[model samples]
Target chain A: MASPLTATPRVTSVTGASQTIPAAAGIGLRAEHYHALLQTRPAIGWLEVHSENYFGEGSLPLTWLERLREHYPLSLHGVGLSLGSVDPLDLEHLRQLKQLIERVQPALVSEHAAWCSVDGRHLHDLLPLPYTEEALNHLVNRIQQAQDFLGRPLLIENLSSYVQYTHSTMPEWEFMPELARRSGCRLLLDINNVYVSAVNHHFDARQYLAAIPAALVDEVHLAGHTRRVIDGVPFLIDTHDQRVSDEVWALYRFAMPRLASVPVLIEWDAALPALEVLLSEAEHAQSIMESDHAVTA
Target chain B: MLSLPELQRQFASAIVDAHAAAQHESLWHDTLLNPGRLTAYRNNFRINIEDALAAIYPVVRRLVGDEFFAAMTRIYAGHAPSRSGNIHHFGAHLPEFLRGFAPTRPLPYLPDVARLELAYHQAFHAGAGAPLSDVQQQRIAAGGYADLMFTMQPALRLLRSDYPALRIWLANRADSDEVPTIDLNAGGDRLLIYRHLDEVEITRLDEPHYRLLALLAAGHRVGTLLNAVSGPSAISRVIQFGLQRQLFSELMIIENTP
Candidate 1:
């Protein structure tokens, strides 16, 4: 099926303003930095927020989002859609998301490629999906349904998994591109998740990066993870509490050329540092994107 | 190979139910997957729900301390698994859960404190309903003052506790560093919690005023509400106070035909 959003122009031209998310680094807008962001108006390219945070009818978060939306091209990244869940789709959640999209008019919308609920019970964490044809078909149909209901395309992100299902038929990199191809959705590639899962599942990170088709990717995510050796087995937990590690940065550098012109986001949810710290992290990503641009150009 | 639905059911069980996790561990033994790795998902489920509860009920946490609060939340999670995908909707039952909890019997006021925090959370996120406009006020004052019915704001939440919940909440708030001793037997409290501009404000209400507003909120006619509250001046005073605080989002006048 053709995507309804395919005909619409990607970059919206407003009165002397571009509504497109620029191919530059942006930061996840957290409540801790709301006031500072408004006061400083840092030279970042754009801002992204978890769509669920502002799902309330009328609250301070929505108010702040409105005020901030005027200055920055915003992206609504949903964490609780549970799109990959086997249960029937949640129409109420879709309704709330559509309302928020109409309110914010975000430049991009996205949800994870993992499920967080089963049998009406929500775990509220991005749980992994098996890389099998059945799972792929299920995810594609769900994403298509969501995109149809949302009246736009969604950027489905990859999950950082610790356990790989033995029933899986293919690798994640293959499954992801195929899902996007079949569902008519774009990919929000998280380089950190790629690196984390690569190590956890014992695959070559570069091979995973190489498998993805560059044209399908719309955004890249950079976040922090912690390394732990549990019961003599090394594990990389996607903590997002600290700085993006040097190893993940190296992986990002490797993936940058393929992800040319895609907007990058620095996500820090827990133990969030000051606005300056996030700005610096964004600056680092901005610098990498620029240096990669120079090489590609 | 298990189907997607069966796998998800087993995985969800492993994360939320400890007994199911042990039973499901053997199913993955044939694969290269280590069953112990499921611990990450288990830990995340606990931490995510606990963090959400802690964010909504900071004062409750402060009153009970970190260790006790963690234990309580674990039990709470088992009893009330989250129904909504949105984590904010997870802990609505904490107040009622605390009422029957055995460990918290000594602190009788804790449940009410939980209720206050929940009210604050609800009010903070409640819809922004427009307050009574000048035209509406004028219409109310023109005639039929007794037959007027007031509609409370969506952000308005009324809570009454047998113990001094307001004092306990004020003392345990994050802004105040000093933990002031609050006498539980001093007096009970009838409190009004509502959103004003961007801040959620809590106000103490006297008996007559609380009764008047409570009745109005319950859709009682102004004349009947006045009859319910004692004292001649108290009715007008309560109405004036409610209007000044923007508690009523709208007002309707009922015509009495004989």
Candidate 2:
């Protein structure tokens, strides 16, 4: 028998042609809201989804994604590329990602500037990487390799680190821009992650934004974080569970000028509220970007 | 000047083994803060893995209750670490883990139920194959029934258990409020787990029908299937049901070789 993969005549392109994402706020698409979003066809600017969620084949997830692709432009935000790992890149993961990109033709594809696996065992959390010349060189090579395989430049988002590296030769803010410049990749500039990591480590969030070259930034992320008070010092964890906190929103406002008109996504992964809640957050972010544009215009 | 590999290996070790943190403290900025801060990572790892397991094995969780399931998942997560970055691929080992898990020894049926759930999960994600073309169907219809070979759909799965796992699964769903009174003496179950379009279904099958699909699942030719079956009606019924439910994705007429 012929292979199942070739059993059907495949549609090579997305139904509605892939379009460039507008410089407005979009909500992170989660499984819980799939039906509601598809049914209502809400007035969100665009949608972002974790690339790994649709890694599997032949399911409601893929089915809904196919239908939703027609209605909204998509951004494939990956959490598991593990760009900083020492192990040889996962070619299988890359192959699946390539397949997804072909099917969806997303406007932008992104992965974190962190590693999650080592020696073939996947830790599943975005683990922090020490900032060093060697680490930077390894990451730059990996990003280039991934870009070569995918035939598209990826937007590498900075990680929300819980702790800082002692042996690091430079700060994360400096490390990210250098990595992006060397790798020929763009920056995702997750503003919430900047706030979370800044509070976790004693650093100014503004300095982190200052180091990123504005032209290289293609996207911005806004999400909620949780405050864990350990030893009376509040450590912010990028939980993505609650509403976009007031402090993170403030940081986003600061980032708006630097990011210019980059696409922003409001990501809420856990305890997802009604679709209206996410839409409202996206609207709020869009208003901020518009106001910034108004000032610049 | 630790290499990138060394740092990742050490960091992964630290996440799994709390004792390994001190040895790797130099890798972090503050050795004093590393232990507590790193504990948060450990918690994240556990939550992510546990949540993946829970998503796949909701019925198993319901059957064993939440607290027991949580404790089981903690041990399972540490012992059987995920091998893939995709969370959906994380809990493939849960069925085997439950087979050896001592605390759940009293619930001997839990392992098979987990196996059933895994089958359902696999079916849910299994790739879709094109149904046999009209010309191919016509050829199969004209060809000798005993001479043809068939291929099951990629989304097809057959599972047999010594417990009423299907019933137990149905009773434990979120929509089910009344506690189902299950009789352990109800004997074994043969389940046909297959995906129709996007929805996955688990159906209990009779022994003969189950045997037929099981044989077809193993790539046995239709002639061999007829030989193993007791009656022609059984063969016809299996084929009809298989086609109706989309059990087989393709049919082939084997060629004679010199």
TM per candidate = 0.94, 0.94
After TM-score superposition, the amount by which residue A69's alpha carbon in candidate 1 deviates from its true location, in angstroms, is 1.2
Q: After superposition, how far is residue B61 of candidate 2 from its true place, in Å?
A: 1.7
- Which docking class does model 2 fall in? medium
Model 2 C-alpha lDDT per residue in residues A1-297, reported as the tens digit of each score = 322222446556455834789888899999899899989998788999999988776555877888898999999999888888887899999999999888888999999888999998998889888888988998999999999999999999998988766678899989999998899999999889999989888889887887788898999999999988988888898899999988777777776666658889999999999999999999899888877642221
For model 2, report DockQ.
0.52
Task: Give the distance in Å from residue B139's predicted Cα in candidate 1 to where it truly belongs.
Answer: 2.4
True lDDT of residue B138, candidate 2: 65
Clashing pairs in 1: none
Query: A1-297, model 1: which lDDT tens digit per residue?
Result: 111111212222122224689999999999989899999988999999999999986677887788788789999999999999998999999999998888778889999999999999999999999899999999999999999999999999998998888778899999999999999999999999999998898899888888999899999999999999976878999999989999878877777676758899999999999999999999999888877643311
lDDT of 1 by residue, B195-253 (tens): 78878899999887888778889988777754567854777777788778888776776
- Against the reference, the lDDT scores of all candidates come to 0.86, 0.83
TM-score of chain A of each: 0.92, 0.94
Off by over 4 Å in 2: A1-7, A293-297, B22-35
